[model samples]
Target: MTENEPALDSLTALDSKAPPRRAAVIINPAKSGGPALQGAIFRLCETQGWAEPLWLETTVEDPGTGQARQALEAGVDVVIAAGGDGTVRCVAEVLAGTGTPMGLVPLGTGNLLARNLGVDITDPVSACYDAFNGSDQAIDVVKARLNHSDKEQVFLVMAGLGYDAAIMADTVDVLKDRMGWLAYVEAGIRKLPGKPVKAQISVDGGEPVRRRIRSVMIGNCGRIMGGVEIFPDARIDDGVLDLLVLAPRGRLGWLGVVAGIFGRNKNETESVEYFQGKSAEITLEHEQEFQLDGDHLGTGTHLAVTVEPDSLKIRMSI
Candidate 1:
């Protein structure tokens, strides 16, 4: 077989001396600059003497799960997610537990995971280089199992309900494409006027704590857009999950909460509450929009979430 064969995904280099590195790129074609990015990736592979990466373009329906699985089955040395958080999350879900390091090539808006890793988001070429020649790190992942459908998902950054999820759900696609992350601010402003959501949440087998909240975000990592610190204590490898509860009552309270998070004092106000846990069971008084990472899932009243620490291996800058 040729040296570039897909079967080279096994860690043969570790067993012996260093071997050729084979990578796979799972891309979402609808993202901006898709064609240019693909060309750049191929050229880099040729110039760097790396194996020709397995290229998989994702459709809106498939995202990256199917393509990522295919790459894994073919034994790709590393899987690169080349889109936004949704695409990254999909690829990470498939790569988890395989011990195959997943790489990040940020190509979409709100590159939350990439931002948390300090991956170069502005320069695709530099980002690709980092992904290809990076060190491996083990991070935690959240396993969210829906109560109504038994549907399971993996969230890499944060899973949120109420106001945060409403913002994601209400974000206009065209506006988001035009204004990028700023569109979320616009949506958040519009959503702030709405009534708060009521939910009962129990953490790590504790008693249910019911509250009327503006937003309840459970984070695997604390970084969010606009440089806000959603949960200051949350770390990707900490073996624990951090929760942010914003119970702001009105515009002034909302301003206070925003100031708290934006100023690095997210837990300093009564309107904002924080908790850490290994698992969370949340039941909403009424069906409300929810999001994992940033993708808004349909309205649901029940959410069961568990964190598995050191479960996924990811690539970071060397």
Candidate 2:
């Protein structure tokens, strides 16, 4: 094991004090090497003297939300999401406000939330070890309600509308798998020519502010991939959501925005506008695509989002 890998066997001492009686693991079989990862889960749980966990396999049709809700209702002491960001988000939605502490077994590409929590994503055993012994931290969650023609839905983490969402929808899975987070750069470059769409935004009943924007990112946490500070001051328990609006006027302005990101100056950039509020409402001039936690959420012209402070209980190593 690597130096950063948590010593699961060493943590057995804690198990003697208070054994973990129950755990529900929601595993996504389609994630990379998900089948092999199962053995690690068994070893860790067995070491802790916990019963064989109730295993729920995620199906493409259901995406694990239903399974997670079922597990939560079944009264498991802990619910562990064993997949990528998408899987984590689905489970988090169900566990939100339920007082059930959620854990992560980072088996996803761009495990942003896990990274933010300082969880050991490279080692499944380490993640599981931390889950049982780690303390709980209250994190903020954003409820994004998209008013579609017939119904509405909710999102967690950063939500993107306009150029960034378009890039997410258009990015190829093969390239993403091969290049990892660099695929976003490739996709962003391809979409730069079509950037800067018009939109009107309102923050917590404020007057509608109109602008031509390349992308709008609603952030619950400050860091994105590559340790990029998308919103430098964003806090997971701040009780307020952060908004990063990129409205680059020209190619040079876009270049400046890129430089700002590299320099971690998102909060101080001229082309970027930042806001923190309890809620926000957005309306695009046309039907624009949006993404939540890296998954496309289809195209829509209107979106309403609100923040719930300390809404989710997460097990964190820190």
Candidate 3:
């Protein structure tokens, strides 16, 4: 086995001293580690003095919220989300406001939340151990809804509209598995060459502002691919959210955005603009795709989003 992979032959609940510490793990079977990952799970729990984690598996129909609630009902001290950002959002959404801490094991394509929280993904065993032993911190959560959709979804990292959403919707699963984050680069190349969505956006219930944009990213945690900081001032525990408007651009405009992203100072140039607010409402000229934490939420002409400060309790060192 590789150094990162755990080697466990017979998985069993370890006999431990004193009262057992209880934890629950909600796992997505389709993710990278697959069934073999369970060995690591059992081994980690065995060593951590945690009980054989009230194991719950996510199905194609149910991602993890229900199982997480079930775990909470059973009085688990921590709820661990063992999938990608989507799964993390699901479990976290349910655990929000309950004062229950949620842990993450980065196993999906974009482990954005885990990365932002400083989880060790290269070593699965270490990742699990970190989740089990981490300290507590509360982070902000955003709730978003598309036009004609009555249901609202929760996102922990960032949410987007237009080009960014298209990249997430169009990225192929096999390509993502084979190329990792390079898959997003390839998909962005394809999507960025297209037209930007024209829309009028209003922040914090303010007057409407019109702009033709490549993407509108609302970020709770600002760090993204390649260690680039989209909004340098954005903080996860802050009461507000940061807004980035990536405008219509050709090759040169793309270069300007790249420069702005890598540069130490913020650019208030015509190509990109930044704003901060507690809520945002957008009305699109036409149907544009929407995404949250890298998962597409379908096309919508109207969008509404709001931030809840210190909304979710997270189990992490950061």
Superposed model 3: Cα runs more than 4 Å off = 1-18, 249-251
Query: Per-residue CA lDDT of candidate 1, range 153-265, in tens?
Result: 99999999888899999999998899999999999879878788788989998999988987888999988997777777779998898888888877788777866676666
Model 1 TM: 0.91
* Model 2, CA-based lDDT: 0.82
Compared to the true structure, candidate 3 yields what TM-score? 0.90
Q: Taking the tens digit of each residue's C-alpha lDDT, what string does model 2 give over 173-251?
A: 8987898888888887888886466789999999989988878889988787778778778788898888978888788
Best by lDDT: 1
TM-score of each: 0.91, 0.89, 0.90
Clash totals for all models, in order?
1, 0, 0
The regions of model 1 sitting more than 4 angstroms off are 1-19, 259-268
- Those runs of model 2 whose alpha carbons end farther than 4 Å from true positions after fitting are 1-20, 148-154, 259-270
- Best candidate, TM-score: 1
Cα-based lDDT at residue 109, candidate 3? 77
Better of 2 and 3 by TM-score: 3
User: Which pairs of residues collide in candidate 2?
Assistant: none
